[model samples]
Target: MTSPSDGTLVAEPRTDAWEFGDFAYGLEPLTMPPVGDATVSSALVPSALPPCNPDLVLFRLRLLAEGGTPDLPDTFTDPTDDQLFWFRWITGHQISFLIWHLMGEILERNTDREIPDRASLARLETYAYGYCAMLLYTGSCPIDLYQSLIRPRMYLQHRSFSGTWASDFVPVRGLFRGRGVARGDAPEAAGLARAVDVHKTIHDGIAARLVPEGRSLLQQTMKETVVRPSERTAILYDNFFMTLRAPVDGEGITSQLLRRLDAVASDVAARGLYPLGYGGDERPKELRSAEVAHCENRIGHLLHEVGEAAATPAKPLS
Candidate 1:
């Protein structure tokens, strides 16, 4: 491993983990395991990543965390309201990307089509709720900015761009969308079902609020029909979020998750998503409702199990 002369951490693309297939399992992270059998001394862990490194701006938080620094950006220490609004959009999407990716790994059918264990199902339920929380911050992006910058770009990229197009999302869509329930009437499955209900409502609410015009995305674009490129949409979605279909390891993502959760939890606790009169003045009227507020509270502050795990540094022991 080549070290940076100034000690800045350099991120590279990983081969073992893909954008959709690799999920970081712990809201409360488990112990970090070695990458392989041989383990000998170095605070810096080695990951055998290839040349086309996927760790872009979107993955900086996770990379920073893995390097043992505070998992958040330095400016986050005392952010202004304007800073909060802009950064929240970036961080919120990043968080949602991770949560969705993790959810995909949990719900994807195994080679033998085995059902996920009760714990994974339970985690699915929990993260379903967490994904909703992520919306509060993301949706908090000023309406003008969303319209002028985000939404227009989305349409320009692909009129039919949707979550259904996401590579990882395809595998887990059925479970969350009510088509596949692994355990018929079991409590674990039931919990996930219930969370799915809440998830849909929150998701739709944010989308509706953001796009009051109510225009539907195109069913299929001309290019899509002509090419029928299976992974095109998936690649587009991944690129939009600055994620890559690369290799990753369990211990790597898990430890990074704990650090990320801690960082998000700190931000949420220090000041609610919108800091009233401080940095943030107010939320849009549509998003200021009780329902939206509830989701905001749930994201970082109210997630008991997930929040607790973030309090400690979850680094791999040498």
Candidate 2:
């Protein structure tokens, strides 16, 4: 008769091996019959089992991604303190500036007049700034529940934003029409897009390999706690692109501009995850770091491209 332990699936196994789905019946351990014909009793036991609650990992990620406050920390009473200042800065000022800049750039190119009305520019800037601030405040949170919560939601959000940005850029080619500026002229956009493509490449490449490696590290460092370094990096990368593509105008802002601003705010949100003082203040030494310097150069190049694109003339939409 089948009993618990030998081949039985009862009494609950370790958390890692527990399968949330079907529970196998307990079977007695016994020697198999000859190879001529193996009976049901002779079936081989599974060498390994899937995790019990995969959702738990995703849920933890969400908590960490959305855990902090913009104006005040839930646990801290000080309102003016910057202890969580990075969080607030990302959600508030940075994003707004990004959106306003993008809007101004787009509007300046599309509008016929050489000089746009000051009032309109002011209004656009205000709206873009306000929305960025709001987004920063709302999106900035702690990393307490990242493994189970934040990662899954962020994955979905990242996909949605990526799709939206691609779709939006299709029609805007008209804004860059004329002025002999070939699509190739915006090499920086192409480069940024390439960087994003590489980021995704690394993400997919390391999904199984790096994710578990990172999780193992976290488990070692903080028992019972699973950290999602890959997911965090992905979200931050998304923010960086959004900011990098922020719209700009010589005049006022527009809705298109706000969208770009949101990108910067998102970048700030992503960067906030890193410890504030982790990078030392040695400019030359710091610049030598490939990853850090690459990002700085990329941002600078992208900004220059956008600025140049804005300065080019556009045929009015008939």
In terms of TM-score, which candidate is strongest? 1
lDDT of 1: 0.51
Q: What are the models' TM-scores?
A: 0.61, 0.25
How much RMSD separates candidate 2 from the native structure? 21.9
Displacement of the residue 183 alpha carbon in candidate 1, Å: 9.7
For candidate 2, the 10 contiguous residues with the lowest summed lDDT are 24-33
Give the C-alpha lDDT of model 2: 0.32
Please report the candidate that would top lDDT against the real structure: 1
The CA lDDT at 195 in model 2 is 36
lDDT per residue (tens digit) for residues 41-145 in model 2: 213432222222323322322332353212212332322223344334333333334333444344555477433344333333233223323332322333332
lDDT (tens digit, per residue) of candidate 1 on 5-93: 97655644333322211222112212122212212223444433323322331243333323323333332336445555555665566
